[model samples]
Structure formats: structure tokens, C-alpha cells
Target: MGSLLDNSLQIISNTTGKSLFVRLWPLSTAPKGIVYIVHELGGHCLLYDVIAARFLEAGYTVASHDQYGHGLSSGTRLHTSNYQTYVADTLQCLEEVKCQYQDTDNVLLFGHGVGGLLAALLAAQNPGFVKGLILHGPIFKFLEEHASTVNVCWYLSYVLPLAYSPVNGTDPALLITDKDQRMKYARDPFIWHEGPRLSTIHAVTTAMGDLEQVEEPLSCPTLIQCGQDDQLLNKTNLTAWSKRCSKTTKLLFYEGAKHYLHMDTPECTIKVLDEMVKFCDVVRSEAASDTDDAVGSEAASDTDDAVGSEAASDTDDAVGSEAGSDTADD
Candidate 1:
């Protein structure tokens, strides 16, 4: 955990003219890169304030926005027509970040839960948008015990899309093991305490299903963090999906931790932050190296052109001198 710091929030309009609550934690000096966070389902960007500040301290500019239908964003609470809306909104946010921090080209994505799925999809589909990804307990596939719930959501999606059904393991107490952290989540007024709308569940599950069928792996570097004891997802399935989705993916599992690894314990949270910082540093260095190599190649080409031009000038001068001498002798 990092020291508590001040941050600012603003309201930005999405492509569809929907207002989204955007926040930025900028560094006093130039940042190594920019980290854009995507919040989980039913969660707000403010929930990631601590982690964002930590990145700020590590010399990174952090930016995030509450997705449509969640937090201060304009929409029905915990609802969206489809998962693509979230992806489009997130892409808009990335564009906005680019405009905001034009100096830094290394933009890393940090996503949690459903947001992780969105980040993975974007990184896979759009390779040049981000430098790396840090996924905290992303839900690519549901556990076997939750298959029935997923089936129900899919069925209701065709008929009663707005119907509400209790989703297991959504309660703050169940997701967060620490009492203080649990209460913090429970008491957050912006959080949706009721069951998620059927359409929202359907959108997420449909996206997951699509990812499961993808044959191509993500092109960028990816780091996945999970709690070994998380009750919300199947570890085996998550591992398989990570291997399938990213050829350069790294996995880190916290022992005895639940869904919320950051809220588990101070030690665990620090370790998570450390790993994230290290990964970002490596990616930033590699990106900088690539830029340098390109510049060097261009410089070498210019030098070669200059040398060739000088040699041509010398040859022309020598030919003119020889002609003048021959004319004098004649």
C-alpha cells in the first residue's frame, strides 16, 4: 500500500454523449508511462484510488473512468445494453489519455474482474493501443459450480433482459476477507448492492464465451494476479484461458487471499504493487530501447547519404580540373 494522496476527478462525455466520471493522478515530474485502469463490474474508479496513487509514486501517470452504467457515469446502475459499450467507452478513455499525456507513449492497462476481460479483448484486437496489461482476478471463465447461473443469464437475456437475479459471491463480505475492507466496500454508496441486471450479466458472459473461442493470443506483455482462494472463479479455467489468450503472460497467485487481492492484507497488497511496478518498468525500458534503435537506424542512413554525396562532389571537381589542364596543354 502507498501513502494516501490527493487526486482529482472530472466528467467526460463518451462517444454516445453519455457522461463518464474520469479521474487522474498525475506525477509532479515526468512519468515513466501512463497507467489506465478499468474498473470491475458494479465497481467505481474511486475504488482503485490507493493503487493509482502507488503508481503515481512510482513515477507513472494514472487515469481511469467509471464505465457506463457504473459509479458516477450516466446510465442505469449496474446495467449496459451490451459488453461492447464498455469496450468502446474504454477505447475513448484511452484516446483521451493520449491527448492528456502526449509526452508519454507507454500506456499500460490495469483491469480488475470484468474490466480484465475488456482489457484482454482490447489488447488482443487492437495491438498498438497499449504497451502491457495487468489483470487482477479477471473473469475469463466461470467456475463449474456457477455454470447454472451463467446458463440462466443467457436464457433470460433473450427474453427478460432487465430481470434481476441474485449473483453468488457478489456480496462484499464474501469477496473481501478482511473485515475493514469488507465494510469499506459495503458502505460505499456508489456501489450497487442489489443483484446485477440480467442484461449486464449476459453481456459479460457472452464476451467471456467469445474470448474462449479466440484462436489468436494477445500480442503485448500481460501480467495476471489472482487470489488462490477466490470463490468467484475456477483457477484451472483462468489459467488455461491466460495461456491461451497471451503467449507472454505471467501469473501470480496470492495464498489465502480471496477475490480482492489488494484489500486482503498490507503485505499482499505491497507485493502486488511491487510486481506491477517491476513489470511496467521492464516494458517501459523495452519500449524506449525500441525507439532508440529506430532513431539510431535513421541516423546511420543519413550519415551514409551524406558520405555518398561528398564523394560525388569530389569526383565532379577532379573531372573539371583534368578538363581545364587538358585545355591549357592544347
Candidate 2:
């Protein structure tokens, strides 16, 4: 993580005046595309730098940020009034990335766990916001051990919605098998360590209902990856959600991997990252195909000069900046 932070690290705030920490990587040359990533619950931008670096090597200018209360971003720590607030915050973050990249299309969304949930919701709610999406081990539900206590949480939420739940918390060993990685995860200062907040849990509960009723049938290219051995949530929910997508959708289940697919064993991580890069290639190919078809349509029309201007505009819209692309201030 430290190694990947070699360039363009920033602490920028959102519209709420809540300081938002973002890790952005602009390619050495003009990029073929751009990607916006959201982190898992309790995850910070630094933890995702490895994945961001992979995007850089793949020739896409990359950007990602910590959500309010989760990382260096300012706000309550891992607590919010409603889950929709997260969705809204993510939408704002996406807008900032688009403005910075001067991109309306050619942007893809990547999320892990809760980040995946928010990304999925954002894409479903707003069509054409992203060209594609890639989700890694998204949490569809809490662990079974945690499930038995939901009713109590739901009832208690009314009394003290912002209170933290008294649970022993997760065992890092369960998150990843490698001892060193487990130790690193345990010691990671940015990870939210203090047991769950009732407000946060309540928001998760409500998000379940919201996701169930979204009905948008995701319009973009989508990819969902889950671990067969994941103790947190089964693939059933993930499968059900994939069915709602209107366009291309692919789901893969890893045999021996755990919840943190990104930080799994070297072999697993290699496979996962390779597959993800390949997925991006498909998106790039599709975008290129669209541009070619647009140019061909214009050429076929009778008006030669008008067609040239239209083709040029289409090319610029897909690749170059329009006018005012925003960048972080100090």
C-alpha cells in the first residue's frame, strides 16, 4: 500500500465540507479510459492502492476515494443516518472523478464488499453513469452468526440508533489465510476496529430492502466475483442480482478463496487480477467498436462537412476533454 502511494495522493473534501481523501493515478500518457473504485466496509483508499496500480499498468487513468467516516474522510466514524447517504456520497464521488477526467462515458466502477453494494446501487439508479462495473466479493448479507441478532438490532435501533453493538468483532484469520496478511489487516490503522454501530447496521438493514426493489435491471456491462468459501454472504443473493441486469453480466465463484478476494493468496490474487484486467479489455473493445460505428454512420450520410464535424465531436467526446475538467486543489 505504501509503495503504491508514490504519486498523486490527496486529501480533498466533498460538497458537504467533509474532507474526502482520494488516491488518484493519472497514466504517464493520455489514457485509453478511466476507472472509479469504491472500497469495502472498514476499507480505506490506501488499502486499495495495489488494485489501483494494476489499473495504471493496464493503461487506464485511475481514481478512488475513502467514503465519509471510513478512512481519512471526515464525518462520523463508520456511522450514518441512512444507507442512501452512502449511495448519494458515492454519486458525488463519481461526479468528481468524471469532472477530473473530463469524462462522461469510458468510466468503469469497481467495488469490494459494501463498496460493491453502493456501486451496484449507483449504477442501477443512474443509467449511463458508468461504461461497466466490476465487483469483488460484495456482501449481500451478514454472517449467519450475525443474522440471529438482526431482530434485536432492528428493535434496539429505534432506541439508540447511533449506539455501537457489543460483539467480539471479526477474527482477521477468517478474512485472509496468510498469517502476514492477517497481521497486516489486524494492524491496519485505517480499518474501523470498534465494533459495529447500530446506525451503520440499521443502514445496512435498510439497504437490503432498497436493493431488493431497485428494479432498474443494470444497463451496463457487469461482472460479479464471489468466493465459494466466503463466510460472510452466500452467492445466492449475488446470483439473484445478476439476473436483473439488462446487458452483459458475468459471475464467477472462486473455489478456495475467502471474502477478501483482492488480498487472497498470491495464486488467487493473480487469477483475480488477471481476470479483471481482461474484463476491462472487453470494455475498451466495446467502446472502440462504438466509436467506429458512430464514424461509419456519419460517413454514410449525404452531408460530408457536417459528418466530419459530427465525427470529430464524437471522437472528442469519447477520448478528449471538453473544457473544464476539475482537479483537486492542494
Q: Tell me, by lDDT, which candidate is best.
A: 1
Model 2 regions lying over 4 Å from their true place: 1-7, 143-145, 166-169, 302-330
- Tell me how candidate 1 scores on lDDT: 0.83
What are the models' TM-scores? Answer: 0.90, 0.85
Q: Give the TM-score of candidate 2.
A: 0.85
Model 2 Cα lDDT, one tens digit per residue, 41-113: 7778788777788888988878888888888888888887688877887777667666655643688899888
Task: Give the clashing residue pairs of candidate 1, or none.
Answer: none
CA lDDT for candidate 2? 0.77
For 110-190, candidate 1 gives per-residue lDDT tens digits of: 989878899888777787779999999988887777789878887887788778755745687668868899999989988
Per-candidate clashes, comma-separated: 0, 0
Instruction: Mark the 10 consecutive residues where model 2 has the least summed lDDT.
Output: 321-330
What local lDDT score does residue 257 receive in model 2, on the 0 to 100 scale?
Answer: 81
Best by TM-score: 1
Q: Name the runs in model 1 displaced over 4 angstroms.
A: 1-7, 245-247, 312-330
